[model samples]
Target: MSLEVKNLSLKIGAKKLLSDINFKLETNEVVAILGPNGAGKSTLFKVLSGEHRHYEGRVILEGKDLKSWKASDVAKLLGVLPQSSALAFPFSVSEVINLGRLPHSTGRVLDHQIITEAMSKADVSHLAGALYPSLSGGEKQRVQLARVLTQIWQKSDLGERYLLLDEPTSALDLPHQHQTLSLARDLAKEGAGVLAILHDLNLAAQYADRIILLSEGLCVAQGDVKTVLTPQQIESLYGIKVTVMSHPEHHYPLVIAS
Candidate 1:
């Protein structure tokens, strides 16, 4: 699904969280929202996911205004993984993943095949029986990913499937972070629009097809990593001095603090 944010602005009391932001996303594209702490990246994700309202602007999904779509209708087309999502009740991994199917299933033959496929894709099949609360941070993240994956896989053929993730790798170790993001890239390649908010510049450069850099509630730079991730822009956005170099094999931008 193509997502277009037009002149988006958000405010809370005395603070402007997002200002005049605009971007367009194409199907099967992986886009990264990158910024330092307090850069409004998460707020942008919330706005895109319809979790936050009372904002001025239009979120268009496949050329239709997002505000006009029903919540369930939107959920069927887009899946979101926020920074921290906790299940109060102790639902098992399988049960949690099954919740993703709620939008499609009407008590018919539950598609266990799809569920299993999602679990395997997320590397959480072993945790299918474990209580969600009992799992570690990374495990829980994977379970949540599995849930979103199941949602997308079930309804992908209906419309453009979009995966919106906010700091999905924050709680994961290095290896798991790579694993999860690689899986996300694979999904994007299979025709899902993946938008992820990431703090790690290296990961963003490695995985994102395009990078949008936000600073002080505005989009400061955006494009391919080589163009958008220059040392000067990085320093201006984060207020930290850094060097941008070429990766040895892939030749994409690589960052190092000066």
Candidate 2:
């Protein structure tokens, strides 16, 4: 199963936010979207998550039109963690995570078990009773991740689940940044499709099976790490000199600014 976007474009009264975007996000792989600022990365993510509708082209989810699926059904098979959350409510961490289970009719007992597992995965078990607003930015980010994890926790008969994360590591510390993407990689190994919008090229290189590069509302290139992240391409995209070499301890490319 796959999520495919073809000839996708969007506009806000002809401003042309995105133009002719095409890509396939498939099961059991982690795909990363890398780009400079104002490259329409977030707008493209909004489209995939069903937050934007006035656009051209198609988003096929598991061989069916994404718009055709019921909101609840979509919730069960796709989980989204956006760039930020503005929630000021004093909900406890566990309560916030429990909201992810709202789309299902699963019994309370099973739901509790799922919530616990999600919290554990996110490393927020000790903060279960803490108020969400009382936590630091990174802590809250992890809680939100746990919530989305609860939403798509199981591989239901509905189909393989897909995850969309918009700058999921923005508020995280150094270790947790790697931790978050590592968890994403692990999920792909367990049979889910994962996509992330990232500014850190090295992080994408380390974790993504493939990379999609965007610039000014269009795709610049898409391919495996070494094929797409040449030094020439990086300098052209960001207007800076750089070096691209293989990581000494790993297989993916390593990028250094010059």
Top lDDT hit: 2
Please give the distance, in angstroms, between residue 55's alpha carbon in candidate 2 and its true position after superposition: 0.4
* lDDT accuracy of residue 83 in candidate 2: 91
Colliding pairs, model 2: none
Q: Candidate 1, residues 1-258: lDDT per residue as tens digits? A: 498999999999989999999999888889999988888999999999998888998999978999998787888899999988878798999999998888776453556887889999889999999999999988999999999888878544447888999999999999989998998899889888899999899999999999999988999988887899998898888888998989999988889999
Where does model 2 exceed 4 Å of error? none
lDDT of 2 by residue, 1-258 (tens): 899999999999859989999999999999999999999999999999999988999999998899999888899999999998888999999999999999999999999999998898899999999999999999999999999999999997888899999999999999989989999999999999999999999999999999999999999999988899999989999999998888888878999998
TM-score of 2: 0.98
TM-score to native of every candidate shown: 0.96, 0.98
Backbone Cα, N, C clashes tallied per candidate: 0, 0
Worst ten in a row by lDDT for model 1: 102-111
* Residue 46, candidate 2: C-alpha displacement in angstroms: 0.5
Span of 10 residues, lowest total lDDT, candidate 2: 243-252
